[model samples]
Target chain A: MLDLFIDLSLFTMLVATGFAIVKMRRLFGVTMMTGVFSLLSAMLLVTLDAVDVAFTEAAVGAGISTVLMLSTLTLTSRIEKSPVHTPWIPLLVVAVTGAVIIYGTLDMPNFGDANAPAQVGVAAQYMERGPEDMDLPNTVTYILASYRGYDTMGETSVVFTAGVGVLMLISGLRRRRRRKPSRDEGEVS
Target chain B: MPEIEYILGHLNYWLFTVLMMTGLYIVVAKGNLIKKIVGLNLFQSAVFMFYISLGKITGGTAPIFPLDMRIDPATVYTNPLPHVLILTGIVVGIATTSLGLALIVRIREEYNTIEEDEILGIEKELVAQENRTLGDAMGGRA
Candidate 1:
């Protein structure tokens, strides 16, 4: 019962935050609300027994992303320009997509059903052999570092690529500006 | 009673749909690039929630085994595969967010604006000028 209540309340907060983010025109408020939204989802993850995910979400979603957004805001405009196009088309599109998803979910396994397909298959083997294979206290850590090491390596490379891409995107402009003493350079400096 | 049970049982999935759609709406409807990125993050997070919820087992505990290496045969661990997948996903999400913001910064530097419509207008004007110059050069045949 308590679990249900927590889940319901967190879901409520999440939806409210989403609405608030949509309604707010101020970029700063929206960014902060995004962090709040992440934190709320992290809490929900915790209730779903996803401690590792909750931890990562709290750190990345709520912490690093918020700081990055704030810095970006400092570099750009804090106020959003009102959209010139009518929102009706987007609204209609979203409603139809959402309805389809809800319809699809009708045949899905009930929440927390042990016999759900996701709970079986390879997952059972991991839970079964995790101790014998890795002997790690955290099954998530064991699987992430051992069974899925290659995937983790790829994810790390992706992070590295993103870092390099950001460096090139942001700093490459400065190198170009230095090459030409033009009006654009003057404005940038 | 069955109706209430059905609703209660499917509550999480229903809410996930709502949150996912809200994110999609923001991405589609918002004009600001930064707002769109935020919406994209929201959308990604909603998907993460859905996956994590799918891995939940009614009576399962967090997937951490005891440190003593003592195996409890009856222990039910929530599926850890999704957790592992989502960990990678969260890392990727932050990477995408940072890369997007970097691009936004560059766009602002070049165009002095990030409003999608204004950028489109600038591009349209540039294309028209290019076509006029090229069309006249080939004018008539070249």
Candidate 2:
């Protein structure tokens, strides 16, 4: 079955990511693997009838996020050596959260059930009435730019703020470093 | 064909979720900034896949209404809305990437390294020295 292949490929990708995360000594490998993981997820979104989400994810998550992180890495070290200690606290927290999520999903609807409340209720209305609400043909656009316009606008602003903050922080550090090298070198104290 | 339709309809989602979670977990667990961003990309792509798959309609033509045809409820229409949204997102994504990369370059020039732990250590030392200087200015030596 096509599903079997998809499942197998996804599983393989996950295993590879796990191995890379464990075995790779360089931070660069981790960054690349993260991108690969995002791309695979986008492919899956296409399968789930969530094309709009997949597009955003591929573009923003895999593309933009990787670049930003890589830039930050340029200012730091590229590899993390085990310091003879494992972080058991974080591991325990993650395990608990994962268990809770899996347990919660056990009672959830089967995939793509047309009669599910989510499918039959506001979602269907959003799909059906979307054309009427916005002059645009894309229902997702209507939902993002009109129905949920405020959220998108807020997200845009948040991104703008983040860009500004990172610039300012780095600029300040550069100034300090410049002063340190020149003033200390000249003082001869 | 029947089997194909069934597989296409359901199994793809499992693939998408697994990859998505893997990326998310890495992003959250990894301390390296670049690796975290990579994980972020993976997470976002999973969401994109969800949008694309919804547009598929069995035996349906493109959503474009032929100029000759009037309103007909019987016409099977492929979903086009998600595609349009995705186009816009792709453009935004590119902008975000360039901005992030630019920031990374700046970060490199500033800190002289890209490792999170080392950067934090340096930052902490700087802060500690600054505090010491401030205390000395007030005649309170720690």
Candidate 3:
């Protein structure tokens, strides 16, 4: 019963935060609300027994992402200009998409059903073998570091590429350095 | 009672759907590029929630086992695969967010405005001018 209450309240806060993010025009408030939304979702993940995910969400979503957004705000405008187009079209689109998803969920297993397809299959093997293989308590760590090492490596490379891309986009290559010196020499002459 | 049970059982998914749609609305309806990015984050987080929720077992504990090598056959553990997958996803999401903000900064610098409509207007004028000059040189081919 307590679990249900916690789940309900956290979800309520999440929806409220989502609405607040959409309704607010001030960019700063929206950004902070986004962090709050992440934190709320992190809590929800915790209740769902996703402690590692909760940790990462709280750190990356609420911590690093919020700082990055704030710094971006400093570089950009803090107030969003009111949208010129009527929101009715977007509303209709979102509503239809959401309705379809809800309809699809009707065929899905009930929440926390042990017999759900996701809980069976290879997941059972991992849960069985994780401790025996790695001698570690955390199955997530064992699977991430050992079973899915290549994927993590690829993810690391992606982060590296993103960093390089951001650096290039923001700072750019100094293509005119030689020309600048020649122009200065001409001026001196 | 069956209907109530159904609603309660599926409540998480319903709420997640609502959150996801709200994010989609912001992305589609809002003009500000940064606001759109914020919406994208919200949307990504909602999807993460959906995946994590899928891993839950009715009476499962967190996916960590006991450190002392004590194996309890009766104890249930939540699925850890989704958590592993979403860990990578969250990292990638942050990377995307940063890269997007960098692009936005460049766009702001070039156009001196981030409003999508204004940018479109400027581009339209530029294209028209180019057609007037270059097209005339090509005997109005363009």
Candidate 4:
């Protein structure tokens, strides 16, 4: 029953975001709504028993990504110039894809069913061995900080590189500032 | 009471979602930087809600020990995992916000306007002037 509610809420949030983006005039509002959609999706991930994924979704989706996108907005336009067009071809494709996904759901086990193939798979290994191998209490932490540490580390390095790039761009700006006073400062030497 | 528990359990999640989306919408669709930050906070707080919710158990007390007392084997224990996860997330969120604000301050200094359209227009004009100079320099090469 709770699963049903979670599914409904997720679908509603995502679909409403699509509609709101189409109807809204302000680009800022759309970005904010995208954050909302991401937050909702994170909640859905939690409900579906993917707590670690939920954490990443909540962090990357609503936190860092929103900030980065907003920063980009500072470099661009605020209001969308034109009303969104309803492109029939893309709409048709999305509709078909959505239909296929819904159809595929028919063959899947009931949400959280113990007998599901998904539950019977390598999940036990993740649960049982995760703590002993990684020396962490939480299986998700073991998975994130140890087993998938390389991937997360790569992502961290990407953020570090971006910070470096920003610093480089801004530092060159300081060089130009000092150069403007070169005639006065150079005379001192 | 069961129905009440059900309602309360999900109420936080519902409110979190609504507030988060409202903030995100403002950030994306609005012209103001401060408003965008406000939206960002909302989005982040919603995630915080998820973490808090995960730590809670029905009828369970806080995950604390009464060191002198004998432990009741039947007593339910609250989940501590989500709280720990959220603590790390909160630190990261604060860092991201500070970084974003710092970037905004720099942008304001350079562009003289926080409005997105105005900044873009100024940047485009600046680039266009440089392009014209380059075009003139290449005139001799052509």
Scored on chain A only, each candidate's TM-score is 0.92, 0.84, 0.89, 0.69
Q: List CA RMSD, all candidates.
A: 2.5, 5.8, 3.5, 9.7
In order, the Cα lDDT scores of the candidates are 0.92, 0.59, 0.91, 0.57
Instruction: State the lDDT at A89 in candidate 2.
Output: 55
Listed per model in order, the count of residue pairs whose N, CA or C atoms clash below 3 Å is 0, 36, 0, 16
The candidate that achieves the highest DockQ relative to the unseen native structure: 1
lDDT of 4 by residue, A1-189 (tens): 574576567756755764575456575786687678667767765554446556776777687767766765665446555413334544455456445544544454433234545434554355445544655545555555665666556657655665775675445555666675786578988
Candidate 3, residues B46-97, lDDT tens digits: the string is: 9999999999999999988787879788998899999999999999999999
Error of 2 at A86 (Å): 2.4
> Mind giving the per-residue lDDT tens digits that candidate 2 earns over B47-136?
555445455554454444444434366765545555555555555554565565556556656676545676788999999999999999
Interface RMSD over true interface Cα atoms for each candidate? 0.7, 5.5, 0.8, 9.1
Candidate that beats the other on lDDT, 1 or 4, i.e. the better one:
1
**Candidate that beats the other on DockQ, 3 or 4, i.e. the better one:** 3
State the lDDT of candidate 2 residue by residue for A1-189, as single tens digits: 575577567657765765475456687777776677667666655554556666676776577667756765666667765433355654565566556655544454444444434445455466566555555655566677776666667667756775775566565666676687788688996
**Evaluation by DockQ, superior candidate among 1 and 2:** 1
Cα error, candidate 2, residue A60 (Å): 2.6
TM-score of chain A of 3: 0.89
As a whole number from 0 to 100, the lDDT of residue B39 in candidate 4 is 58
Order the candidates by DockQ, highest first — what do you get? 1, 3, 2, 4
